[model samples]
Target: MTAGRAAMLLALSWNMKMEEEIKKILDNKPNLRYVVTEVGGKASEEFRGKIIKASMNAAINKNIIGKNAYESHALLHALSEAKAGVTINSSMSVSFAMKVAIVRSDHWIAVAMFGQSAFHPMTNHERGGFGIMHI
Candidate 1:
């Protein structure tokens, strides 16, 4: 892998470990708040956006920026929060999102992503998502 790719992987791994540590520390505390949504497709954006607004009571704007840095933003959001829940489209995105969430925060659980998951392995690495499901 190129140096840049290696660096990104290293950073991701580090973030995952840090999230775990943070969760362990916060588990002792009481009353933590969090939310989760599956972030994909055109309809998904609307649903998740509504959820965010309802949960936070604030309007959060999202722009289509040619898919430049999804993982980074997701990871940052995960790390900044105490607990998080994630909903994924299928087994492929589930796995990818789980990895992202794990790197962001330890207190995360992916809804599902085990059976009949077929993804374009090459593209998955860069986009951080799975392609399709084949049963």
Candidate 2:
């Protein structure tokens, strides 16, 4: 693996291990599916939005069809009835990780509040959602 990729993986593992609060919240649930991603780049907001949305769809799709979601209109016979009803994902500023976790479900997660986010502080909206937490 590339050094950058390896570093990111290590950082992700470390965060999962060190974040007691997140572990407590998860409580080793056997059903919920979660994702970890990084979200800071020079790309346009439109691009970022699409990436976030697609990632969510793909994660959920994999849970059901045993493959990536293709936005198919045809009926997909369930390979497995099991799927996550709710999804949880997290992003943090570490060696390499998503800057923030974005969701369309109209809820906020974690300590950051950035662009187009409902939660805010006395700062630029675009610069919002960058709150740093150990979790």
Maximum-lDDT candidate: 1
Superposed by TM-score, candidate 2 places the C-alpha of residue 132 at a distance from the truth, in angstroms, of 24
Q: Which 10 consecutive residues of model 2 have the lowest summed lDDT? A: 78-87
lDDT of 1 by residue, 1-135 (tens): 222222123223335476455445444434321122222322244534533333222112221111335533443343323112233443323223332212112222111111111244454432232111110
lDDT of 2: 0.27
Whole-model Cα lDDT per candidate? 0.28, 0.27
List TM-score per model, in order: 0.22, 0.30
Q: Looking at model 1, which ten-residue stretch has the lowest summed lDDT?
A: 108-117
- Predicted candidate 2 versus true structure: per-residue lDDT over 60-129, tens digit per residue: 4544112333312111211011011011121221111132221111111111222221122332122322
Candidate 1 global CA lDDT score: 0.28
